[model samples]
Target: MGGSNTSHSNLKNAVLAFLVPLPSILFYLTFLYHYQDDDPNLLSPVWKWCYNHPILLANIFFFFNVNVLFWLIGLIQSSHWMIDPYWTVIPVLLVHYYANHPLAVENKYNVWRSRIVTCLTWVWSIRLSHNYFRRENWQWGVREDWRFTDMKHQYGKCWWWVSFFAVYLSQQVFLMGICMPMYVIHLENKQLDILDFVGIAICLSGIAIAYFADTQLHDFVSRNKKLKELGKPVVPNLDKGLWQYSRHPNYFGEQLWWWGLVILAWNLGYGWTFVGSLINSLCLAYVTVLVEKRMLKQDYRAEAYQLYQKTTSVWIPWFRSPLIGKSKNT
Candidate 1:
């Protein structure tokens, strides 16, 4: 009965999570569809102003639609769980939004590039959304990322306010920055070249690598759970498959995808967009340190994880080094 009740509650929460932000999404899409091409005479003063400055308009929409609205919801729920799913969905939204903006150049080459990138973005979003749902056991709003929960504890009473900046505002910057390439993609109509193909290759490779790595990691965790249930010794760390080469193959793949997009923009003469992927990579480096520290703190996994760290590359896949001093059995 308790299990059934818990499942029912989770399903309700999932439905609410899906429904809550939907109106904002629909409104944004409607606005874009209605104003795809700016008409000075037909538009309201405010709409005309926004239509002139699409990027600024996007930021404004993000501020209210995402930052403020999500913050309020988080405050009410006491969990910033919604942001995880949004991370996957936002890039897709930004790409299409930019493609449909009046500023977008509608040439044959530009249309081709746009369609390719949009399809790739959809593929990436679907894979990530799948992983998120699997990780959360299809439940929503029931839990937040461990990092956010830790921050809440760290800040105590101040978390209510601190979360606005730390969670929502920070995400706004990162998401917009990372999606800048999509904005640039629509701005120019350069002919498709070999570099475009190269970008596609890199992006697809990243998606494939991330998919496999995440699958391996998920299986590792599931197997460990079964081992514990059956009173057997669980594996201390994942050191097989792609995990044999990099300490965080999934993150490595994610970086590849972002950098791949940067390459696309760079080929279009907007190389400065690399800043977004660079910032994301640096942030991931910090996260890598935190994750390692967490692993080391665990008594069951600490020793083996340390050994694994000594042998494996941190982000890039490479040949494993010789064991530092002695084998685990020694």
Candidate 2:
């Protein structure tokens, strides 16, 4: 019984790590196929504008280049993206697929559905891509993804390959896979239902929360950059805004968005889609709880963050005061 139990445990652990990043598989296969040949065309006015803003163009190029790098990593190390799984969404072009396929017109409304999703995704991607490249000293090689760095160091030798690919690369793949709700449903050639509206609303709300939290954090942190120069309280880490509710609200909202995608997918007739998102969230939540409980708890021990943690809910805004609270600035 003991031996059998040990075997079962090993099997469970193996499967958990393996399937965690499953979506990247589909992304790598589907995403690269579009590059088989390029349509040669002169630049449009918009293209010319994009070229003029070289930095913005470089940002977009960097992200797409990152996409290529991710696939290359998969090809080389058989690894997956653990931190940001949505990186896989690039290849599937799930929305683009449904928007133009001959069958799209069979359900014209669904075509619009795909367009909406594709639009939102581009907006988010463009924002993130530009934001990343905005950094002056951006370098590509051997960058540390906080989570993966810990995992790599933890496994050291014994399960290095498994730790690298299964835990890391699979996350990227799964991100692409789970992002399929909007694209896949459009492909199904069906009308959008009330569920679609709910999903859309939830996704949009998530975007707003994520953007707000990120912007607020950046502003708050940067606002005090001068103070840090003067030697003071910024790195003390203010918890005035959404940071009040949870130590890692940005990460929480991101987790929620993927789960929102999962929910939307499930509503679109894809059963068990929530399972994929749930697992992703659970993994992230564990990481967040582990890290934040130690770090944030250590830093913001009693005053603001702990007060917020005690009072405010983490992800779901069940009951709370408005985020528009008094800040050090105001």
Which prediction has the highest lDDT against the true structure? 1
- Candidate 1 residue-wise lDDT, 1-330, digit = tens: 999988887887777767766765686666666676545558777767756888887887788878888889889878888888989988998898898876789999999999999999999999999888888777676689899999999999999999999998888888899899999999887999999999999999999999999999999999999999999988889998999999999999999998899999999999999998888899999999999999999999998898898889999999988774469541
Local distance difference test, each candidate: 0.88, 0.54
TM-score of 2: 0.62
User: Once superposed on the true structure, which residue ranges of model 2 sit more than 4 Å away at CA?
Assistant: 1-94, 97-106, 130-142, 157-163, 294-308, 318-330
lDDT of 1: 0.88
The TM-score values for the models, in the order shown, are: 0.95, 0.62
